[model samples]
Target chain A: MPSRQRLWPIHVILAVGAAAMVAPFLWQLITSLQTTGETTSVPPHFLPSWQWSNYSQVFHDTKFAQQFLNSVSQTVIRVLAQVLFCSMAAYAFARLRFPGRNALFMLMLAVLMVPSQVYLLPQYQLVQNMGLLNTLAGVVLPGLFSAFGTFMLRQFFMSLPNEVEEAARLDGAGTFRIFWSVMLPLAKPGLISMGVLTVLWSWNDLLWPLVVVNDDSKMPLTVGLSTLQGEHLTEYPLLMAGSLLASLPMILVFLAAQRRITEGIALTGTK
Target chain B: MFRKALVLAGVGALALAATGCSSSKSASSGQADSGPVTLTYGIWDAKQKPAMQEIADAFHTAHPNITIDIQLTPNADYWTKLQTAAASGTAPDVFWMNTPRVGLYAGQHQLLSLSDKPGFDNSPFPKALNDSYTLDGKQYGMPKDFDTVGLWFNKKLFDAAGVKYPTAGWTWQDVISAAQKLNDPSKGVWGIASPDWTQENLFNTMLQAGGQAITPDHKKSGFDDPKSLAGLQYALDFITKYHVSPTAQQMTDTQPDQLFASGKVAMFADGDYDMPEYKAAAGLDADVAPLPAGPDGKKATVINGLANVIYAKTKHPQAAWEFVQYLGSKEANEIQAKTGTVIPAYNGLSATWVASTPQYHLQSFIDQLDVAVPYPVSKNTAAWTTPMQTTLDQIWGGKVDLTTGAKQIAAQMNAELAKE
Candidate 1:
């Protein structure tokens, strides 16, 4: 009976947490369906006629599809680049013995402590000098390398058993060969987890894209949604519809990788 | 090792290819050898884009050698981007600037002086409008249009409630009495939209009450003065004491404009810029009247205008200045006025503007301009709004008494003024 009581408390806590997380999304869904008149009613109606045409209107009114494509391409490129570069750098710092590697790794980690806003102006200037302003490269290049990714992967790599690598080294394999053939395949969960995070961050980013891309045609989903919002200020249903579309891609990515992410977390804990 | 190197090389090659594709794409869009010089014109309002394009087309007919490119940044992001572009020396050749921001940009030497530009005949624009763009006796921008705040009321609501529509001669007490009689809470109808934090609308109210929003030299806050305090007290009492307007929390939840547009409120205070939106949303005819007089029997309103200026860093200053001058011409202002986008600053174009919107008494806006006071502003205006808004919020929220809130706002505004 005491065990049952303890289980009841756990269920109650989880139920509350789940409700808290879901309440906002449900509100957004309901708000997205409300007409302009119903949206600002004095009592604030919670449910109104489902204006499903709002989704169609958002697509028809703005360059929503093109912006969605831009966001997808930028996010895919950033995720792949971060995963490859961070893992390679993490392997070097964790396992390889090279001159000045420790100091260099520390310097890289120190960059993580500096706020990203501090580098905004200089980074923008650098992109301008390189003639990459108003281009997707400007958005993708600055975020390709992340110190947080390196540190996380480095710790994961370090916590791995040394016997497998030694055995691979004895089998006529060099540093790159072992890292690529034996270690990389085993680090799939970490890479997938990092890729999901990179995609999520890149997809929702606003300020940098707004600064770099001046043309509406070149803007990503986030900036495009903002412009759409400004143009259709009186149309709340359409704005909410566009917001729902923008969030769909990230939601799909999260669900698809949820299993791998949980497994990666469990593995890290065991280490 | 070779395989790893190949992968790294592949990634690097992909990045380089992507960069090349983007650069080549932009290059192909605008042919480099085209003899007609391409000039970029920046504006803040997308709603005004059609009128600007019309002006651009007309300018192109006269100066066939020049091509104008329209670039729009919204109002909130315009100044920040303009400052950055100015710092980088890549600002558009011609850009829309406002009175509040022109002083700072001009002081920094970032705007091309238009005082000597040909075709800039100031005789066509009102003196008050032209003076807004002039600083230290030198003009940096040319007046394009002017606007003022007024009471926009729903004629249908007034007819339904059996309340007579507000006239230009009404006083503040008249507005309150009518609001109290017309309010029907059970029917989701309110009498007014008492804006909580905006100083532009409230400044006119204060001035009508024989008060000032700031000192003459723009050094101190006038909110602590009895007249200013009384003005704010009257505004706050509409929501707190009389319950004619929505509470602060209700206004914060959804903007007052939304309430008015949805017909939940009978009246709202907004500028001419919102005229198109209200007409489109409300279905019924919405009319404008001069702001009511205060207890001091004075009627005041706030007047402001937008201007067209040339960037100092432009590669083609002469061509850009020509475009800017043309935008301020009667021809361009007529197009803007006809479109109901703004009230043209050109003296005779206001009648055409009034004719474009026949649903409302749009001429009342121009009539009120004679008594309109310019928005109280200084070089450090941005520094003053933050704290001033916060203290005013307390007054609107009924957390602090009107006198205390006024005193606190004055102290904060004075500190900000000292920093300048």
Candidate 2:
């Protein structure tokens, strides 16, 4: 009886937290359907007539499909590259025995302490020197490697026992074989977590993409959405509708991966 | 060894895929494809795309050997993006420039000087408009258009209240009396929808009262001057003492423009750019008049203009300059005027612009240009405004008195100006 009573408060707290987190998205969805006059009405309208054509209008007004494709391509390539490269680097730092391995690991971790802006100007110059301005490669190259992912995976790998890898090595498996066949599958939680993070960051990145890409046709959804905001200043309904559409992909990703993400977070806590 | 080979193959495939995706098909506007030539024109407003395309078509007709690509970036992101492009030496060949940002770009030498460019003439532009874009006796941009602030009133509201419509030479006292007479609180209407604390909006009023926002040398604060303080107090009195304007909180909840559009306010003081929007949204007839004069009996309006600038590092300088010249010409101005997008800076184009939009009286904008003072600005305008606006907010919110706020802003402005 006492346990049941304690559980009720926990359930209530969770319900409230979920509602609070979801309210803004719901508001965005509702506001997107409103007319401009309805949006500015005094006391504010909570419900609005569904203007489904706004979804079609967003595509008609701007190069939404092209930008969406750009964002998807950039984000997918960036996330996949980060997962593979970071996992390998983390494997080397966690399991490999080599000269100055600890020092190299420390140097990699040191990069995470510096802010991102310090690298912006130099990185921009580097891209410019390479003649990659206004190109998708420039947007993806800077994010292809992530020190945070390396550090995260290294910590996760360090927490795992060596018995599983040793067994594979004892069976005549080489270092690469052990890492690829034995260890990576075991590091699924960490990889999943990092993959989600990489996807989220790359999908919503604005500043770096803004610097690299000049052509509107090459712009990602974030930059494209902002342009829509400025061009359609008085058309709040359309802006809101565009914003709602832009956020849908990220929301759907989170929803689909929520279970794995929660499990990863719980594992992270224990680690 | 096989696993390692597999990983290497994967990396190679990824690199190949990335390379394939990075390739962009370049679009050219001219017939010539032999030489190293690509002219990029940067514009801030997408609404002006049709006009820009027309200009580009005209330029292409004249010089078929040069390609011009119109690049549109919105206003808020334009400067930051341009700065990034400037730092990387890949900025568009030619771009739209604004007065507030001209000094910084010119001081940095990021803009191409246009004073000696062929087919360039400065005499057609008014002296007041031309002076804003000139830096150190060298011109970086041709004055493409001009704008001035004015009080836009709803004629239907005035007629309903039996109040006389404001004319060209109305005083601040006249405005206050008319506002008081027209005000009916119970009907959810106010006399004026005063802008919430913009130096651009308030400075003209202070200047009309024989005060300035900054010292003559642009090194000190003029906000602390008695006349400037009186102007601020008068703006505050509309909400506090007179109760003829919405409270600070109400203004915050809904912007003054939204309030005015909803017919809650009888008058709104803003630029001519809002004329089309007001006519479209506010279902009542509207008219414009010069900003009311203060006790000194001299009316002042803030004058600002936009320019087309060529980037310093453009690969096709000649072609870029041609496009810039075309955008600044009377032909492009006529297109803009007919669209009613803004009052074209060309001297005689106001007639066409005013005629294009009949719902609102746009002649007041042209008249105010005669007495309009340039917006007080410097290379470090943003730095000074940050602190000035914060202190002004406190005064408007009634948290501090006007004198104290003005003093604080003046001290802050001087410190910032010294840095500049």
Candidate 3:
């Protein structure tokens, strides 16, 4: 091990890096408690005036509790659906000897290349036709499957040893049983990382919800927070308060899953 | 094998479902007038949403069977959502429309014509506003509100500098002399905040200089014209030659509006739309005056307005029209004026808006109406405006000379106009 004196430079560098990462959140916290006048002052106000009413003002203006529930439920559904569907499809591509498997995999990979905006209109129309606009089902349906999730898991599944699967088959286990009882347990890290990605994406989704959901009651937190913004003028203090309040749950979640997230990311080999 | 079959069946089922959706959509557009109607009204401003809701409630009182649902999308996503919704034939029954997009939406037949409707009168609004939504001799939008550029000054800053407040008929020379006096570098204060903005700054200057941004026919660019170049130079000289205004980089760091509100900028050219914010800002003593005249003693301001327009494929056209008509009525305009959210486009309502915020001379924006130029726009204004702004940024940054930049912009703008 290196001596403490020898490692001082690395520690200093890391401290600076950590501070840089944390500065924006600290600024956001300060701004959330400031008045509109204080927020826009030149040279900026490092110390807040502590106008806590800004948080109350956000709640008064928007349906905060309802949007919080909407965001949570939608994020949960999207994460589960992506994990369940992507894992199964990933397994099939990794293990099954299906016809035109290469072509199918290539086609799925092509989806990852195209931007999500390209699918927005067609997806919106499809949901509209299904009479699912402004409903939880409409928001979750498009997010249920993702090519990136499938591809990421497929790579993980392929890297697993074939001997373990052969051993399971020798005991007369079917493909479904082997995938559920044997392979799934081994692919836990891949599934966790994919689910984490899905959670982040669904939680932050603004455009699709803004398009599909017209009612304030049906909006997710992201869309509801956006309503606080105006065409020409926006109350930054109120917006920051709402954003800070909205991000609390996610921050707690990240703290709880910090170790698992890092471990999963490392095991999966790609973010 | 079973999973593969399930996937194939799923794909086939989705295709069949899509075809089924298309068939149902055709029947939706021809909805009956007898049923209870709910017209979705789309708007982007959160500050104005409450006033809009009040207007909607008043409409609902008159037409008990018709309900108005207001949809609020932030301005950033409003156009994107509108474009997508329009493409799918599921746009809002009525929505707010601006001058730049009126041409495209009307030309594409995505908007319903309000002129042909019975009892529809265009005389209640200014001609410049009416002409903004009229294309090819047909009116598609009912003017809701209008905004014009004005010289907003900080009274305290003017007094501190011993400069008299700018009044009506003040010329450009007066502005330059006052700015030179007011500028205080030690206090980190600029005489003015001059940003490279079109509606609020450049277009008004261009018109005041007896120059047009585009030809009357809207088939060519006027940016390369000598008069237009002079106008461009006039705005540029504030930063480079006069050095009384904040640099482009400084304005970017702290937006011009914020700088003005914080007393760091003595004067700013902005639209009346920003009055509500200025009223709410604490410790800022501000007032408005008409913009100074150009070299030849011509006073001009660029005027733009928002309109209430009905989507062409609305399920209940009659109900939508009734709501739209109510929105354009004197009562609705009064409500708008009382809220001070906007200067109502309805004739003679400027006094009502001015009284709503009595501290400032809101009438300055209204007084320029006589000389106000219609906001110059083409079928696809963004095609040229977007590029023109990019080059103007370079010019404002002192990377390009005004004459060369103006000619470059004119050439690009002409090409876009030709395409249109």
Candidate number achieving the greatest lDDT relative to the actual structure: 3
In model 3, which runs have C-alpha deviations exceeding 4 angstroms? A267-270, B1-32
- lDDT string for model 2 (A1-271, tens) is 5688779989999999999998988888887887666666555779787877877888887799899999999999999999999999999999999999989988987888888755676788798998888899988998999998888888889988989998998899999999999899999988998898788888889878876787779999888776664332356777778878887898898898987667665655622
The whole-model lDDT of each prediction reads 0.76, 0.76, 0.86
lDDT per residue for candidate 2 within B1-420, as digits (tens), equals 111122232232222233232222112322234564668888766666777777787777777777678777766556656665676567788887776667766766667778867667887777777777877788888787887888888787899899999988799899888889778898888999765445336887788888888774566778889998877777778888888999888888887766776677898787776664566552546788878988879888878788888776666666677777777788878878887777777888899998987766788888877777776767656667666766777888889887888899888888878877
Cα lDDT tens digits, model 3, B1-420, are 111122232232233234332222222443458968899999988999999999999999998999999999987777777777877788899999988778767766778788877888899999999998998888999999999999999999999999999999798889888899999999988988888888888888888898989887888999988988878778888899999999999887778888898889998999998886787777899999999999999999988989999888788887888888898899999999998888999999889999988999999999999999899888766667767888988999889888899999999999988987
Residue-wise lDDT of candidate 3 within A98-159, one digit each (tens)? 89999999999999889877678789899999999889999889989989888888988999
lDDT of 1 at A122: 62
- Candidate 1, residues A1-271, lDDT tens digits: the string is 5688679988999999999998987877887887765665555677768988888888886689899999999998988899999999999999999999989998998998897745655677788889998899988999898887788788878878899999998898989999999898888778887777677788998878876777778889887776643322346677688898899877887788888666655654521
Residue A118 Cα positional deviation in candidate 1, in Å, after optimal superposition: 2.8
Better of 2 and 3 by TM-score: 3
Return the DockQ of model 2. Answer: 0.21
lDDT of 1 by residue, B217-240 (tens): 667878888998778878888898
| Clash counts for the predictions, in order | 0, 0, 0
Colliding residue pairs in candidate 2: none
| Candidate 1 residue B228 C-alpha distance from true site, Å | 2.2
